[model samples]
Target: MKKNINITEEDRKIAAFAALAIVIHVLESSFPSPFPGIKPGLANIITLLVLFRYGWRFAAWVSLLRVTAGSLLLGTFMSPTFFLSLSGALASLLAMLLLWSSIRPWVGMAGISILASISHVMAQLLVAWWLFIPHRGILALTPILIATGIFFGLFNAIIASSIEKRLTDTV
Candidate 1:
């Protein structure tokens, strides 16, 4: 007797989105950073759009898959980089899920994006402080990181909003 896996169209859709996120992640990794400890994270724009258009589960799957697969592609699996990526993604997903479930009616994509961005940045900073740097000096960078998070969060939301509008119009 054969068992059915119950893979539905939704699974395929999630896979496609995850693949896109993975590609963006890998491509972004190739870019030269102006300095260390700062990434604009444009790939997160895709995850935010998916979260609003689809659901938290799909977004979570795409995000984690992208982190794992992208790390493997970049040869950072099981490394410090991989842990940072995992931590950030998990934190972002948690923030999104909480906001989406509780205040979705009152919150727009911008709010979600901003909150998720903050959560991601904070998670990464904490992880770096705990696992990598482990110094009081690391706390000094919190303000800079928070400012960057706010800027990129708003920027990414604007882009995601336009992309969502276009996608909605085409469909």
Candidate 2:
């Protein structure tokens, strides 16, 4: 049975953005990190830009697609690493949704990005502790994870904002 599936312009836009994010994700994954779970998460800049430009829904599509497709490309699909990434992405999306719905008028990009980053780290930590580690030591990484999250969150937001500005200027 052949059925025609209509694809909208919006879907194409989402796929293009998702592809860019996935490339960044793969490149970031190739880099060596001082800590096991620490990365710059440069791919998130795409999500942030999409969120501010389009909306939370578009951003969520980009983020989730990046995580899933990136994992497949990295051969980590269905692995512990995949689960961690999925959990972090889901948590970040949830945080973005909440902020977008509530205090979006008051919050700026940095604030939203920081909160999302912190939530992502926390979710990954909890999932690690619950599913794999099951040790108190995993929780000990909380402070450092949070610190990096804030730093990277702010960093990504700045980059996103710059990109957004350039995009607006061109358009």
Per-model TM values vs. the true structure: 0.94, 0.97
**Collision pairs in model 1:** none
Per lDDT, the best of the predicted structures is 2
Off by over 4 Å in 1: 1-4, 169-171
Query: Candidate 2: which pairs clash?
Result: none
For candidate 2, the lDDT comes to 0.95
Largest TM-score belongs to which candidate?
Answer: 2
Question: For each candidate, what is the lDDT?
Answer: 0.90, 0.95
Q: Report the C-alpha lDDT of model 2 over 1-171, residue by residue, as the tens digit.
A: 999999998899899999999999999999999888999899999999889988999999999999999999999999999999999999999999999999999998999999999999999999999999999998999999999999999999999998888885332
